[model samples]
Target: MKISAGMIVWSFCLAMAAGFTRSKPDIGVPVALAYFKTNAEVFASATGELQQSIDKLDDDPASVIKARLALKNTRLQYKKIAFFLEYFFKSAALIYNSAPKYEIEEPYMEYREPTGFQVIESLLYEAHPATKKLELLQQADVVTSSAKDLNALLYGFTANDKQLLESIQLELVRVITLSITGFDAPLLKTGIAESEMSLRALQTVLQPFREKATKTGVEVANYLSGGIAWLHQHPDFDSFDRLHFLTNYALPLQRSLQVFIKELQLQLNTTHVLNYEAGDLFNPAFLNLIAFLGADSSAQWQIGLGRRLFFDPGLSGNNKISCATCHQPEKHFTDGLTTSNAFDGHSHVPRNAPSLFYSAFQYRQFWDGKAESLQSQVKTVLFNVQEMNADSLALVKHLQQDTTYSKLMGAASPIDQIARCIAAYVRSLNPRSSRFDDYIQGKGPALSEDEIKGFNLFMGQAQCGTCHFAPLFNGLTPPLYDRTEFEVPGITRTDDLLHPVADTDMGRYPLFPMDYYKQAFKTPTVRNTAATAPYMHNGAFKTLEAVIEFYNQGGAAGLKLPIPNQTLSPLPLHLTPNEAASIVSFIHTLDDAEPTGLFIKKSNQ
Candidate 1:
């Protein structure tokens, strides 16, 4: 029988259907295991095709197109298995499709260069693909080798039913935050199709559990089918109604999956950043703060104690400045200055004082992301000669002199106690009581038409959601929020849009000493931008309008500034003035509603 191409495609689809529809299992493990085995083989086969296509690349223009097509197919095949592969083999998965940028690991501080599909995608889509042939061949080799090693790792792997469900839930989060946002497929813009493929694979693995789930099972199936169909109908990248998709399909799907899991009596492991108990994505409790910062039973007491320390000027060398000096509560933890005043009171700090609200959510701290944790950030600010300029011994003794702090200090080291207490106060700042949060949770007034439009623009056309992910709207990437991302937006020295000159702040480069890290600063949360003014690391843009205009013109690159490594796309957003104002209005909706006791004023000394 001579196998025709159409027959080969049909056979492949048939085999996949058989794998999914085979005798329904009692539990999810067997189904997951079978799906993994089958998809792993498919991924390996697609990888082989990619390798062959890459080998055939030459002066022939058709060869390049064939290679690109092969690469895209291989990516789609890999998407079919991304859920399990990412959940089980996270480290290896990093090599497969992490961002095509140099990553610096914290603490140990190891620099890992980019590899895999994204790098290949960038190479293939570049203006001159022929020039990148050598590098493309190398990246292809890395991907193929990594895929084979992963297959080896999956040979006899076993996972519990609860873990499989948990992985599925996380995959939904990934699809919402990463896949639909074109995060991994920057050049290809194939995130929507990839999301559909991922959902199809998820549906296959979920069949056994879905069947057992009864009524809840029906809800889950409808959401899966509906979401897939929605993606199919709206294939255009720029005009895709992300807001509608998220509210109607993605959010409902997530809720239904939880219901299905509960109905099946499956327990989820709560060690991840995503809180399994949260009902919706924008719930105040959406992220597991406890997972981000280890559980503190005494957080309430620590927060109160920390508030006093935060307001005490004795913590500084001159006994005149406190944490509140730079981070004023009334101003939303920012001083409303272009840059904060230094210890000398005559000079200014190099960077703006970013709001402490939602500060505890990210893995890295500071503009350069040099501090590894909130505690480290507290310590660094306290001891820095240019900032607080605190004398460690004197500060400790000063705190120990206070009866209240002395009691809290007890047997703990004074410095450690101070750091912990102040850090605790900062951690307690995130209230997540914004109007947007309320609307997302189905409680607040419906967002205005303009506000809704602005949000859709932010998520899709504006491309803000790609970096400032939803829920937290911070650089902490979702699914597994282990790493914080930094980007170089090529900010200018001042708010002058017409005569823009690239700022001389080397940003993360001074710490990492890498070219790519140049001008790369940690992406901060825009949740309270309405309160925190003078945006960016240097606070060059005074008004929110100026900042929006700067971005509208595509950062410094759009301003014709020299920024070879600007990570922000240089393409103009072309936002009308009205559209810009609408976005600003939408951002205002993110201001936290008055919490009962968010701010604690200075004590009478």
Candidate 2:
């Protein structure tokens, strides 16, 4: 009795199912695992066969079309196998790793039932028998050369909704045609191949019940158009930092895609929403949103608000001081005094108000790095008895009554929203196009000989950029918001006319409670460092030269300021005074021409 191909396929499927069931240790393991393992083997075999056919075609022109068809099939089979493997791995991983106990309240995973290992094992075994038949079909699809036969094979893959496989088939055809035609083909075979690939891939990925072709085509077209537009807008694509762009765009795109996939999953009652939109995936608008969200105009508003909040004496107990009394923008956002003069008139704050420029990049705020975020620091300054003696709730209420603040806080959450907005504005205060920016951007003439020498010293011998970093020249990590390392350089204990505080502030230790953070402070941006006077956590240094010299000698002698975990180096800088001065000159080059609207006076009531 001869076995028909259809009967053989059915029998092989049964065997695969049996294999799946036996392999699973429990009933809960997916049967898809069996299918994936079998498909991987089939794909591997097809790839091997296709390579042989390609070698034969290179030696024989008559067989080119036949070889190309075989290659297409091989590619398609491999892609289908690869796609399923990816799906299986991702799904299996999710099942194996349950949500953390603390994250039980998370909205997305809250409803998922506890999956048992036994149940998983049973499902795994049930899917095993079908694997053999699928593998055979995949192999057959790869070696076929007849256009009708190839189309039929392709249709089957699409019917299974394996879009990535279809796309791979299209890509293989395009490449094979290009190789044969030498870029001068009259028919532009590659274009036809691409169109077919797109159509098939889109069809496979879209919902089985929907008008797959039309809807998928529209989505693909839109994605392509958006990509083209983005490319046009950013013509110097090679110059733009790829990692930086990707890092900036990744979060927003991930969030958007997750939301989209969730919506589709709900509509289809299937877990594989990404598979449907696989061929038409990108986030053009999210990328565009980056620029507007971090622009100078926004920064201006933030800086102005910071200034207003800084100077508003009403926040203080005596209504005689504000943040600006210490951190004056005119003094590069620092009071000229060594230590900040607080609201109690004669009481001096423990540390100086560092310059606000490029501070948005720092991990922690304040000279002691007591606040983990800018918002926290703002709150501290507003509520501290020694500074602004205002209650946060009362401050919010007071601001709500003011027409100016009321208008600014319109429809926004009074406290958190306002704090975030102010932070947003501050983060946008990136003063690019400086001499250093010009130098980095290839405008070589922007920096003078001394300044250029200074830049080299800072990055090399001086090792400033190691802490300050590039572009923003602050504590910002290369492409993300990882906190900068804090350092403690011992300052001399002083007895003053006002509030005499501890000689050593213990910087970030009190807030972080980490041993390493003791006496550590966030590294301030070097941009506009020249203008901000009286440096150091205690505001002990009076000049850039003084600060540079202090670092040159490696903090205070025998001060036991532990080797900062994130220090640029353990070795002393050992810079000559002349080199130090050169670095100072380079630091001076960071000052930006003051922008308008940053210093607008409040309307006289």
Candidate 3:
């Protein structure tokens, strides 16, 4: 009558499948708390079994397979409560499952080694798991501790209907952006199954609310059912139709959930970067653009002043250069240079002047991410010796002399105010009027067959969507859009893939002073990429084709460059020329129509 670990897990699954064998109908916060507690126990149990298997590595040769199975089951259990755990207790979630890379906390300079399930997963899937036995055991212990800690935290955990619904929505986004991309499960490629489990958990969480809101509930349930079925049908990682999965299942589910929440009369109390009122993910209004700026009516008034200053050459040390000189409005806010002209007009700036469109959406500004905000970025540019090199106090005095400027300023305008105003104008640049935007919003003509294929390849095989993400097509991660990501792609000094030498520019490394951050640059948006040529932080590639080829060659590492800390995968993507061209065509679809000076017009009024 002794029960094996497999039997225990099977029994737990059976209990979960039977709705935890509760005689009463599942509904409300009490049911949710109960489900959470029970699931936590199962997770803890699975982790314990995994630890036991790891401990038995030397005694039993089959323990490696057993440990792997146990780890998978443990992760599956974690998925059941991932919505609650990840949303409510993000710090604890990190302990349970953080990225397998070493992280360094900025400013504080505290270096943290990788830990949790991803660490253990990498070890278990390795060719020499036995050689890493000690490390595996240590990670297993960490997972066990984390699982128990999660259980401890769940003791008094309580969530209202709105919170639960919001968590579910965020979970859906995570599935789309992170889970199915094999981000967390890079070695195992178990994300597809994990995503299905995540959806099932969401369904269970919504079961109580569904009874309260019938019509919207039915729509939500159907979408969930269809999405889950689709995931179950297509479990393969690389070949999965991500674009179809996103458009047909995930996007619709998000829309339905919004309606379902409204029908239940529950409004989110949290302040998120995303505009909850936006009905579609790719809708232009999907993100709250002003949320980042902390803008007000007065700030809106400053945009006109900002636009004037932006076009004024007097702000610079010399009387001849303006922001518009480099960020020409007609050229999609890029000067069509490999790097912009310096203050001397003879020399070039160190990096390319990226397109201003959608720049406001990013969490960080600048290629090296040295500037924390748009205002900060503007201030740096105004003072950089190689760039504007303007004395702030003098610039302020010079601007105040103009009667029109004095009228706009309302008596006094500080240097900080000037930077703020310019930042406001820059923030107003996002028009989201691309053909891709129109297509995603369902208000424009269908994309070409090549464009669709390119999009699929981008999202699926090319692994572009894994970093750029959708809607914004930037490295600002979705669900929480709080953190912008920087990666060391190991960009080469030249476009020569065969004799690639790593770019000499030390990118974020100089600021952070970490080997890991060497050549780490912000992942800029591909929104108007076709318009803004000569890409990468250092403008190493002169054309979009070269940029695509660089990626296709799997960055510098694939070209046999010694970029030990490169974040991009070294293995080649094996994309055909037609495939690469198609991706480029899809990128062209992201080009916004000419800016009509939307903010300038409003400011003039």
Candidate 4:
């Protein structure tokens, strides 16, 4: 009755095979399986070999080179396996579980159908495999027993041949850790509806092909049916209300599939497929059905909306400044200024403009946690006199006149529609193709020694991950989508001209009225920290070293700012000047190239 990991995996595989029984399996599945099997076996063998090498090192320490090589190989193998596993889990779940079925078919129900396996597969192939590879690399560790072993490990890690492992490891861990909630019960539950919806959407897309694309489509449908059957049979199935279930699991799965399809297209160089017009994937009659099921929310729409709003000057006051002005796309969606210039231009905004890349996973919105939702944050920026300076009514009125806005907003109330569209877009801004991403995916040789050292320090002595957390690398408070908690870091008024204020800025408490939230700010993403300068509230520091030194000394030394309960612990990083520079270099590697012309395009009247 007790299922081992192997048994669990086997069962899942069988279920998958059974799901596709009516037709041939999609090529992606087999390719993924082959890759998974090969990597798993290689890793297992590599681990054994590494253990033997370690044993040999006991007798002859000079054999550290051999042990280091074995370790590196084992690490590389593990990276390959882990990346594929994540891909498989995401892809399979999309193909088999991302849909919704009403208990009773209602005449009034309007549903949006999901995207199909072909679409998902296409997207998956398009994704830069490097993104996943970099994530895996980030999670890897280089073991050393003594000075001799340390030297050997460093030598091997820095070797030209081993560059792949180093780079892949750095990027892999960064992406993977931020991609999913690791074994967190509540977070998992929260993700369920989205996942299920994604699966269901994929099913809808595949439904038409079931009779035509016999092999791939039928196979996908079968797996989906099995997953649905399993869900119905589960004892805890009825615990959640329908809405909760759909939002948490079903939708997320659909989203994942959409994302996967984009990845596939990227990998296969099938950009044409992605550019296919709406209603082309399914029959004309089914188009309405798809819309009713909410299945037409393609990755393009999601990602484009985020990018659009991100660059819209209308979102801010004066029609001159926009999110992009502060969070420059070329600089990895960070302004590269220490602190951002507010919309008014005369006053400086407290805190540096955090990178918008991979911000969806963050728990809170601002440094002081002023806004509760991403939507709220957007709204705040629109209305804040010093920031955007736009009245919500005026902004809504302006958007209501736009034809494209009409399409994106659909039938919802204007404000709600706009917010959701923008949020949908923001959520799609996850970064994937950094040097670190490549390393995580398996092509290795992406990062340098200094970068690797910084990564280790971040996870180890620096304790940066404790606050930044995984995957998204932002403050992710529990209870999915409950808005993030804020912290007051007691930033000082340094000699920096940007934030020359002598007093502290009261952060969240002013907005929320909670005693504990006084001066509390949201944790920003570190995905492109190197490009976002003037760190912290008031943007006092100009460089990464200055920020590191501030953290090492712990809080503005002589500042009269009140220390909040959640302030970071003093970390005398004890990093030498070179080590500090290495950490900075590593942070710079987090940048992803700016999104191209589409993001930069002005709105068509």
Q: Write the residue-wise lDDT of candidate 1 on 37-80 in tens digits.
A: 78888888888888888887777789889988998889899899
lDDT of 4: 0.46
The better candidate by TM-score, 2 or 3, is 3
Candidate 2 C-alpha error for residue 294, in Å: 14
User: Once superposed on the true structure, which residue ranges of model 2 sit more than 4 Å away at CA?
Assistant: 1-310, 392-397, 408-425, 442-445, 479-481, 490-503, 557-570, 601-605
- Lowest-sum lDDT 10-residue window in model 1: 290-299
Pick by TM-score: 1 or 4, better one: 1
lDDT of 2 by residue, 38-71 (tens): 5446655654664455444332444445444554
- Candidate 3: regions farther than 4 A off: 1-26, 48-73, 104-112, 123-130, 293-300, 392-394, 408-412, 598-605
Each candidate: RMSD to true structure? 9.4, 19.5, 9.8, 19.9
lDDT of all predictions, in order shown? 0.82, 0.46, 0.80, 0.46
Cα misplacement distance, residue 102 of candidate 2 (Å): 28
Q: How do these models rank on lDDT, best leading? A: 1, 3, 2, 4
Off by over 4 Å in 4: 1-299, 302-306, 314-318, 391-402, 408-412, 477-485, 495-503, 512-516, 557-566, 595-605
TM-score of each: 0.87, 0.48, 0.87, 0.48
lDDT of 3 by residue, 329-360 (tens): 77888888889989997999899898887888
> What is candidate 1's TM-score against the reference?
0.87
